[model samples]
Target chain A: MHSEKELIDGCAKGDRAAQRAFYERYCGRMMALCNRYAKSTQEAEDILQEGFIKIFGSIASFRKEAKLTTWMTRIMINTALNMQRQKLYLLPMVDVNDANLYEQEEIGLSDFHFTELIRMVQSLPDGCRIIFNLFAIEGYGHKEIADMLNISEGTSKSQYNRAKSLLQAKLKAEQKYENVRGQKL
Target chain B: MKTSEDRNFEEEWKSALDGAEMAPSDHVWNSIDLKISHAEQGEMKKRVLFYQRVAAASILFALCLGAAGWFWNYEDASVKSLASQTVGENQKESASSIAKVPFSNQNSSNSSAVTITESQNANSIKSAVGNYENGVKTRIENGGKNHALASEASNGSDIAAMIAPADKNVLTLGKEAELESRRTSQSNTGFENGSVTELATNGLSMSAIRLTGKPVEQIESARTFKIAKKEQSPTDDQNRNWWASVNGSGGAYNQSSSSNSVATSLFQQSATSTFYAAPNSKEVGVGTSFSYGMSMGKKVANRWVVMGGVNYLNQSIDYQTNIVLQDASQSKAFLADLASLSSNLASTNPYVLRNTNEFISVPLQAGYLLLNRKAGVQLNAGVAADIFYRNTMTDLSGQFGSFSQAAGDNSVYRNLNWTGLLGTELSYKMNRHYQVSLMPGFRYSFNSVLKSSTGSTINPLVWDVGFRLKYVF
Candidate 1:
């Protein structure tokens, strides 16, 4: 496990070994994580490249208390979400009054992986996907989501509910579509 | 701790992402290594060239200065080698002393039994002279047994034959001392080097390199002494050393000149003659020592010689011409007596002595005796040069036949001559090395005129002084 300091100093010196070592160890996990936050495969790959560049460039600031891989994964996620936000697309933010629209249905074991499930959740409209990822998967409360996204607490909770309701209906609708096609029962 | 919840979700997402795989291509690392090597190579080359240049310059400077000083020592070694060669003859004399020993008559007993060691001791001292006298008195009493070694004292006369220009009395004393020292040392425990080993001899023979340094050291020490006394606070030890050096360099300078005449006005019949008598040939071209020097040989050899000096001299040229006076005079000339001619010049101070000075030299030398017969003398030559600074306007005032001071044409006073010298020297070790000798010599400059138009003459000569230091080498 090479540290961020050694990797950074080595990279500045154009050390190929240090660069290759860092890439081989963490690239795979960061790319998958990028896919969840990005709108398309191209967008996800772009985020992975850009985040790694930023990581190497600003590596001097790293205090090294956290694992290097964990630090890298967060950078990748931030890069993808920020790129999507900069596109200025309207987010499907939910109202706090729309809480009843969410359904707490139990999930069944399926051939699809949790990685696939996370990707599906990220495919929601922009605002809903961010709220859904932060509140449900990332476990931030409404107040933290509000502070992080620069929105009101009411708006954050409302957006989180709308995201949950949208994922539930999409899952139900995808199930029905499969049932009608009869490719699987 | 609140971030713990976010971290948990991050971990879950990470686990979900674990199945994905993507690796960086190898090109990035290859690019970095290539860039670094190029930068390092450039820096290393620059550093190496810088160090190489510094090393080369430092080596060159050291070699140049070292070679110049080394050349001076080469000259000294030649003189020493010649002096050492004189010892070979003493060994032959030693053998002859042994041959004279052994005849049976009671009167001849001591002379015939004269051992080599006793003869070596008796060779130079009063005891040796006395013993030889005793042998002769014995031979006269008994007649004929002590005749062999008498021929070898005749050999002392042989060495004396080669030493001309040397004072005979000093030469005799030096020879006797050398023979005595050899005889005494041989009579005592057979000490090394074959000469009577005096304790002082150990300190006397330093080396040539040390002798050459005396001039520079004398200057430095004199300067240091002056500075030591002037300084506000100094150790008593430092002042003591300076005084010791000054005292050790003790010598005196003296000058004398004479002129005789009577029945004079402003001048009379001058004792000094005016005719020029320049040497037809140069004896030797002098060196540019203009400084003192000292040398030291090994303990077995003689040490300590201080010689070499510089002197500055100046003079103006003046002369009379019959052709010029005959051409200018219109009336019948008056007859002049020898005293009147010298005393009342047709013209005096005709040309302004604008400037005149050159080297007037005085050199002091001292040395140690290496062997009783062979001792070294340091020859110090003093430096001098001529300079003419004033002009010839005084001669512009012409002579009054009425013998009155008045102004006239001074343009005839052309070509002022001035002179100077090269203070060069060489050392010699005569048979009796410590016997003091003085062979003062002159170096004359051929330059007769100061400037072509100045009409002044200068006499340039470099003189050397000689002195003896008894070897304690």
Candidate 2:
């Protein structure tokens, strides 16, 4: 039940108990954050392991200027981004013209499982999914995402728009299918 | 300044995933734990290595100083004993010459009256004295030039002239006959009287020998004695005080176990990574090392030398680590996909890593002569403070070409370390000024050359055989 400051001090000194306590305390949220950026459970686990390793390695540099959770979240996100970059370097980029044309229509937001929503986000293309997560969930602007991903601001915006349109289309289709199933019942 | 529709969509997504949680498999923590534990162990190893180096350096420095001091005191005592022996020998020669003159004068004056008896007596005295003089001359020749004894021998003629009058009664016929019989009997008994007399002279010289009572000529002769001694044994001459040597050595350098294990772990980790297609096969060959240095030594004693100087060594190692690519067809599709994203993925061949390092060291060495002859051997040991000069890595292209560079920055290696050396030199004396030697030795480092954080704690154990050419002054 030590405070965040005490845990950080202990972790810096490489106290095993303190490290385990710290990991258990923040791992759920961090894993969820990693999950948002990864396409599968295994990839998310990989990112999670890499992120915690970094946190423990650099805990001495954590001056507690920001909240511990905020600092850890930033580390997790960076780890996921690096993992994406490595994977992206090996894969071909999809043509921009292949993005599905869709209308910007309002979609039902209720009655969707949280896991289903995560699935929808994960289903987006690799480049579009990262931009979408950084912009929509991580609260980063298009300019920041562009700098982070080494792309133009316009590309970041276009990628975000494509991800949003695709998610909207999928959500709408799922909601209509659920309604049709209810009518048959 | 976000658009309304964009703001709504972001809010919807955020709320939808607000409490979403997925616990990773238990093995994720295990993997993290393993990495952290390895890093901690590495840190501990570094600290231990550093302390070991300090202790080793301190012990080596103290030992060199202690040996030099001990040998210096011993040499001083030997020189004093030898000087005392020379003074005693000089006194004996003086007495013997004085006794001989009277006998000679008596024999010449009374030749007709006691010709038969005196001739017999003369023969006896001359035989005994000649034997003693011949023995003394042989000792002087074999013991090298002794200026004190040579000067005293010359002064014997003067002593004989001074003591001639006081010895008249002792030189009478009856007493002379008795003295001859006694000298003859003693000579017959194997020079026992002569030996006793020599011992008495040694005691007297030790107590009463005074350079102050001597004339200026005698003092000048004593000075010349030292010059003659130096000329006789030029190798042992204290006046020739400087020596220089050039040596070159080659040996095999071995890495420590801890470092090798850590490197293996890292290689395994890389092999398991998704980027690499196959497991790495690492072969570490015997590393070839070469070193040469020029050092100047001072002869501190007859059998001791102390030297301090700089040395430079370049060590290179060739370790082939096969970065086997996956099946060509499977990798082709992957490479084509990778090519569109980054043009740097042009080649996919296994590469070899060649590591080279250079070092400069300042060594303070102490040597003791175990044997001194035409063929001799000596033992030497010292401590060296070594500074790392450079480390270079060359990736020779494999079947395809070189892949992305994976080596860490060379600047991360530790710049300074200390090593302990123990070696023996087998030497052949060519002349008074030049000698050649073969020095075989081993050097052990007490600290790692690379930083611990790099997880590479390479400490080299090197065995060297060197050829040396030396000049002594």
Candidate 3:
């Protein structure tokens, strides 16, 4: 039942018991964030492992004015991006025109379970998946996402729109199947 | 510029996934823990190595100091024994010369021999006196007449000729001779056989052996006998006070590990993949340090000395870079021109880069002797102005060869650097003219070796063990 301050102080001094406690307190929430950006569960675990290592290494530099969770979350996002940067160069990201931003459609994600939502997000293309997680879930603007990924702002918006359309189509087909199954039953 | 529908869509997605909790596999924590342990081990090794270098230097200094003390004491004992042996031999020679001199003028031939002996004795004594005054070798001939009979006989065979010139007369009883022995021997005292007699005449003393029945060859050998002469001590001269020393040292040079931004940035961007671990400050290590110099020191006071000299100092460092050849594409900053010239950069080879910095350092130091004796200990503190000469970067693996940059030739290092020095010298006076010393010292640079604009701070510290040989004039 140590306080957050005591836990942070202990972790900064490289106390293993405090680090394990710190991990247990924040890993589950951080794992969900990692899953949103990573394409697979294994990749998400890889990102979480690297992120925690970085957090422990640099915990002494953490400013007390910010929440520990927010600091740890930032490290997780950066770790995920670092892993993605290697692949982005091999599989080049496409640049879209500004007119492609108009093709976005509104969709309801309430009908799906959290696991099903993660699956649909993971099924998107690498560029779309990263851009959508940065824009839609991480609350970053298109311009910020473009700078982070080294792409054009229009490309970030176009990738987000494409992710939304694909999820919309998947949700619509699932709803149609459910209605047909109800009639058959 | 966001629409209300777009805002709602993003908010819904954030709320849905942000609170979603999922546990990672247990192996992830284990991997993180392993990496941290390895990094800690490397840090511990670096700390241990630093202390080990200091300890080694200290042990060598202690051993050298102990040996110098022992040898100095041995030389003192040997000199004392040699002086006693020379005294015993001189006593026997004096007694024999008195017994062999011809004392009788009973025949015309004996009278002529007496005249010849007196003339030769006068010439030998005059020559010996002249040489002694000139601070040169004093060799008395003609059977040790004046010195052996007057000086050795009266002083009980301990004193050689303690002669002081009396006007034109060079042969007389010196201050060391006893009045009673001079008066008794002056009365022409005869031996038990009445063939040997002591005679004093015309400011000359003679012990004549009247071998009237003996062969001429035996008399000739006795007449040619030459006594060993002791020279004046060098300590009596005030001019032989200055000393010169030549010294050599071997040790390690350490840099302050806190600021290594230049090396860090170079290593971090070497590999494109995050799987390979990046090199840290601990990997930048001391390689070798060596210096040799000569200085002239004089005892300014009873226990203090001052010296200044020039030294050629060389320090080296080993940086274990992370730039493997297979990952050379991303690390264009290192050897970029060579990389562009070659098409094949796919080898997964690694090499260590050794950076050597050479300097001409001038040290002005003052020393204080804590124990000033044959075996002595001195504490020295000083400062040096080190001028940069050149730096050579060589691939230790022999693959990349080497390159060098001299001062003001597009070098990143500063031209002038200041260093503080402290040392303790354990010295032994081997003899009147020679001494040997063991000096253990530490040096620390006050400013960075590199330029301020380079954003790299490198203050080097050196621990060395020096051996110095000194000669007193």
Best by lDDT: 3
Which DockQ-derived CAPRI band holds candidate 2? acceptable
For candidate 2, lDDT tens digit of each residue in A39-88?
Answer: 99899999999999899999999978878878888999899999899766
lDDT of 1 by residue, B132-213 (tens): 2111111011111121121112122332222222312111111111111112122232222232211111112111110010
Tens digit of per-residue lDDT, candidate 2, span B147-220: 11211212223332222333211110110011111121234333321221121111112111111211122232
Name every residue pair that clashes in candidate 3.
Answer: B101-B208, B101-B209, B102-B209
Model 2 CA deviation exceeding 4 Å by range: A92-102, B55-59, B66-473
Top-scoring candidate (TM-score): 2
User: In model 3, what is the error at residue A170, expressed in angstroms?
Assistant: 2.9
> Chain A alone, model 2, TM-score?
0.91
Interface RMSD, per-candidate values to 1 decimal? 24.0, 9.7, 9.1
Overall local distance difference test of candidate 2: 0.58
Q: Please give the CA lDDT of all the candidate structures.
A: 0.36, 0.58, 0.61
What are the C-alpha RMSDs, in order, of all predicted structures? 35.5, 23.3, 24.5
